[model samples]
Target: MNLVRSELLKIRTTSTWWWLAIAAFLSIALAFAFNAWVANETLNGNAEELGVTGDQASAAAQAANLYTSGQYLGLMFVMLIGILMVTNEFFHQTATTTFLATPRRTSVILSKLVAASLLGIGFWLVTTLIDLAAGAVFLSANGHGTLLGEWAVQRALLLNLLAYAIWTVLGIGIGTLITNQLGAVITAAVLYLVGTQVVGLLFMLLSNLLNSEAVVKWQVIWPAIASTVMVSEGQTDFTPAWWVGALVLIGYAVVSGVAGVLITRRRDIS
Candidate 1:
């Protein structure tokens, strides 16, 4: 409990958390505006031009998208926090003191994971409240029924929380591997922002080359796409089950967390 509290205190004392939170706040607001517009277009019979059928499935999918829309940037911010959670210790020269206090390195790592997960939940809750409010207002104005009553919509919201937590774990893993705070953050940011796009393009090219949609199933193999899959209602008829996405994402987080702990135990901090 003390270790966890210490980690939380580090986050609270830093200005980084609030800066990221502000960025996340603005990102969610923009996402809701855009998604709400899309939903309105779909509901108002602009389906054909938009490639939607304006059906229940489409509406539910859009609602799920809107309900958890903050995830795109939210996960990124969580991951950065996770990275800083560890890298900050090293950067500020507090890691030695932390390790000296808690000689059992494993315990420290575990506490960090717990704290990062809690931070993720906090981000998830804030975004969810904003999303729900925006979605409710948008739906009512459009004369569309609420998908809040639907299980799929609810499931997406729940899974979104899971995504946020896991991303932070991955971030901590990155920090553990690369203690240079600036390098770790830049590496993570580039991989997340640019890497996802490049990966998507690669998948598209592969699908085209194969002349088959079957290759699309493998998209979840990538951590970013796996997060998307974890929350999506459905994309195309071939979308893998949500649980498959969950498993793959969990696999990444577990591997990263485990590797972080193993390396930290052997690595020389000085």
Candidate 2:
């Protein structure tokens, strides 16, 4: 309990928490802009570009999609929060003092894992509230009406929170495994922002060359897309079952976390 409290205190005392507020602002602002644009399209009778067939139901669905899509942009910020939670400790050479106080390496790592996860959830909650508020106001102003009651929207929102929380833990694990702060941070960014897209493109090229539908299904196993599959709720046919996608995501967290714990336990802190 003390270790957890200490970890939380470390985060509280630092400037890192500011990123959460920034993420919330960006998320809400972008969501509002996107919703407003969709509303414009709906009014201009060009909603067909977004697959809205000039019907109330389809328009509501399209609006819901636009509203939720912007919230995912905040995930990158939360991912940075996770990476910095541990990487910062190493960057400042504070891990030696932290270990001296705690003595037990496992306890220290576990506390960080807990702290990062909680912080991640908190970040998501704030971002989600902002998204809802901004989405409702802008969407209603644009005459699109709020679709907060839609199950798909609700699922996407909740799953988005879960995904971000897991990402923080994954960040902790990666930070622990790779002690180099810059390397760990850059690796996380590349994996999430660029690596996944590259993998998808490569897979698509291969799928075309091989002419197999199965290749598309294999894409679901990638952590980034798996998280999307868990939240997208039947909107995309290429995704696997929700359970399968969730397992794939959990598998990533577990593998990275376990590897980190093992390395932390065995490595010498200089």
Candidate 3:
């Protein structure tokens, strides 16, 4: 308990937490605006192209998307909270002291994992509230209503919360592996932003070259795409189901987290 408190205290006393929170907030707002625009465009276009039932499904999908808007950016910020949780110890040269106080290296990292997960949940709550408010307003104004009672919207919300917690835990794993604060942070952000797009395109190209859309299914191997797949409104043969995405992400989280803990046990803390 003390160890977790210490970790939490470390975060509480720092500017990084608030700075990241602010950035996440702004990112969420900006992302909401853009996603709203996209949702509107999608809804308008679908109404023109599809029949009644199809249009209704499209509207529901867009509503779910609106409620989960800013998800990618919000997740990116939560992940940073995790990466910094471990990297900061090295950055400040305190890993030795922490390990000495705890003696059980596993326990120390576990506390960090716990702390980061809690913080990630915090971020999820904040973002979810913001998304809900924006979604309700937009839906009501457009006469679609909030659709809050819809199973799809509810599922999206629940899955979104899970995504936040897991991503943050994964961040801790990343921090443990890299240890270099800047390297880990930059790698997390860039690889997520650029990596997802590159990987998607590469998979698409492979699928085309192979004349098999099945190749695109491999894209979920990347955590970012897997995250998207988790709350995805639609699925096709080219992509796996939502559960598959969740499983792929959880697989990465477990591998990276366990790898981090095992390495930390033997790591030189000088």
In order, what is each prediction's RMSD in angstroms? 1.7, 3.2, 2.4
Clashing pairs in 2: none
Candidate ranking under lDDT, highest first, comes to 1, 3, 2
Candidate 3 residue lDDT tens string, 211-248: 99989999999988888788866676566777888889
Give the alpha-carbon lDDT of every model. Answer: 0.87, 0.73, 0.84
Who wins the TM-score comparison? 1
Q: What digit string (tens of lDDT, one per residue) describes model 2 on residues 1-270?
A: 788788888888987678666766766676667766766776677765765442332545555555555545566666677678788878999988988988888888888888888888887777666667767876688665787787766766777777878888888887877778889878878887797798788878878899975677678777787776666544333445556777787898888778778888898888
What's the CA RMSD of model 2 in angstroms?
3.2
TM-score of each: 0.95, 0.84, 0.93
Number of the top candidate by lDDT?
A: 1
lDDT of 1 by residue, 74-130 (tens): 899999999999999889998888899999999999999999999999999999999
Candidate 3 weakest lDDT stretch, 10 residues: 47-56
Query: Which scores better on lDDT, 2 or 3?
Result: 3
Ranking by TM-score: 1, 3, 2
Shift of residue 179 alpha carbon in model 2, Å: 0.9
> What is the Cα-based lDDT of residue 23 in candidate 3?
89
User: What is candidate 2's CA lDDT for residue 44?
Assistant: 71
